[model samples]
Target: MPDTSSRIARPRLIEIIAALATGGLLTLMVLSNSMMAAHTTPLFSSLTAHGVGSVVAGIALWGVWLLRRGQAEPIAKRHIPLWAYLGGISGALTVIITSSTANSALALTGTLALGLAGQVVLALIFDVFGAMGIERRLPRKNDLIALAAIIAGTILIIFARGAS
Candidate 1:
């Protein structure tokens, strides 16, 4: 039956987590930029550390969320989305380190490789959800569009960063 009941609930949850993740990253970016502009070394360093720390902490937090939610609601044919979030953190770290080493060809190539790898991981989540036929029931035109845009933006980020 594709769990008609879950279509509403699961989408809501997926939207919520995605929003929170996006908002958290945006807020961190803004705060970090503001602090750097103000020349507040300690605050900038602390905020940067906090942002990185939050991602590491998210691995545990999301695993718990998945465990709790999966008991009643299974999305993407028993595949867990929490792992994707962890990969995202690792991907960002790879990009940061590589971008910093712009002179090194290995670093530049590695940055693109990591970013694409993370996107593929995310795509796998969507693909599984699709194969499960959950998305078919949702009819989420707006959500799909947003997903496409985000993926495109991510690709652009990888390209732009690589060239810089």
Candidate 2:
């Protein structure tokens, strides 16, 4: 029989790509926010950056959607939930908060540490609650352990002033 492993591997490959893209985005945010803050106030910089970025990203996504229109399933805007559309509001707030907080005594690493810690906790809450159409997944002992480790590490990083 012919091997059909490629189909089985496709999801994992897509997950890997998504992870890489997310990581890249986080890194870019760190660098850009830091640099932008240098020229003006953090809040102002963040607003400008996010405004420009949103426009560029919107255009890029639209272009990509247009190009791939025939190859993939058409997305139904009506089927998307109202909650899903509100994510941009949260994202805009994130840019403001993260930019204003980062590099303001906390520094990049410390800011990122605390941010990641908060993100994990919130994500766990969302997962457990099955919020926003996600499937419910209760946290286990291992999840607690991981969260503890992450919190501990973040605390350590925040306090370790001499290391940076």
TM-score of each: 0.34, 0.64
lDDT of each: 0.61, 0.72
Q: Give candidate 2 regions above 4 Å deviation.
A: 1-21, 71-78, 95-118, 162-164
Deviation in Å, model 2, residue 109 alpha carbon:
9.0
- What TM-score, to 2 decimals, does candidate 2 have? 0.64
Evaluated with TM-score, which candidate comes out highest? 2
How many residue pairs clash in all the candidates, one count each? 0, 0
Candidate 1 residue spans exceeding 4 A from truth: 1-113, 122-145
Q: Estimate, for each residue in 38-134, the C-alpha lDDT of model 2 and write its tens digit.
A: 8777777777877898899999999999988879686664467678878878877886677657648976666777787789878878766677655
Please give, for residues 28-128, the per-residue lDDT of candidate 1 as tens digits: 87576556635754344545666777898999899899879847664455555666547556645643554455436556546555656766676657554
The alpha-carbon RMSD values of the candidates against the true structure, listed in the order shown, are 9.4, 6.8
- Model 2, backbone clash pairs (residues 3+ apart or across chains), number: 0
Backbone clash pairs for candidate 2 read none
